[model samples]
Target: MPSHRAAGLVAGLLWLASLWLPAISLAARHADMDLQAFEQNGWWLLTAGWVGIFSGQPAWLANLLVIGLVPTLLMGKQPPWWVSLACAALSLLSLALPGTTIHFDGGPYRVVAFDIGYWLWLLAAQIPALLMLTELNVRRRAK
Candidate 1:
């Protein structure tokens, strides 16, 4: 019932918001961001460059974000026998990545509970939007 453009816009907005949430959380808590580790591998640079690129054309990037989430949904690691496993897998992946954590209990590392939740929740929304768009495209082609 929705258009590809609509899907893209929604997904894009959510994706962009998702990226910012972690930074905001960290700042709010006065938590130490492991920037040195994030920078050492050029991952941060690559990520920043990516965000910049997405900034130019958010809708298309949103579609891409949805596509990316499909893999996570399929094989991540939650546990619902459906989208759960993949969400779980994505949670683990989120943990593995930089700039995703929470630390307020006098620990060396930030906890990743919120990071994984945000990523997976946003992803669940994205994956369906993408699938709807894909189906729409297919139906149009058939007609």
Candidate 2:
């Protein structure tokens, strides 16, 4: 078990766990609508094939991508670099896109912030990317 492979396993597990955590937290200016309401409305992390609280189609796609990539990440030894790159790119895109936007009927608006899940997912994606790059460089050097 190489260090990079171990790291990938840990990161991949973290990423899987993150899917259950809140991807985003919401705060509204109006007291009438609070975090609980949004949460109840399904604004938490996606699990069991259900979308996150604020997550839309993109979120589902992101999850599927991660899920699809995690196995490759676990393979570790001589894993395809392209898969890692794709996962990294998808993670970056997911991080950049705002999960969902909720508007209240008031003068003020809602404030949304990235949560633990987002950071963990991003880290998980990067772990494989970095490892694959390093492995490729090491192999090239040896040759």
What is the C-alpha lDDT profile of model 1 across 8-107, one tens digit per residue?
A: 4454455555554442223223356433221111222224424433334222233344455444434432212333234334333433333443233354
Task: In candidate 2, list every pair of residues with a backbone clash.
Answer: 42-53, 43-53, 43-54, 44-53
lDDT of 1: 0.39
Q: lDDT values of the candidates?
A: 0.39, 0.58
| Clash numbers, per candidate | 12, 4
In candidate 1, stretches whose alpha carbon ends up further than 4 angstroms from where it belongs are 23-110, 115-117, 128-143
**Total backbone collisions, model 2:** 4
Residue 138 lDDT in candidate 1: 88
Residue 14, candidate 1: how far off, in angstroms? 0.4
Q: On a 0 to 1 TM-score scale, where does candidate 1 land against the true structure?
A: 0.33
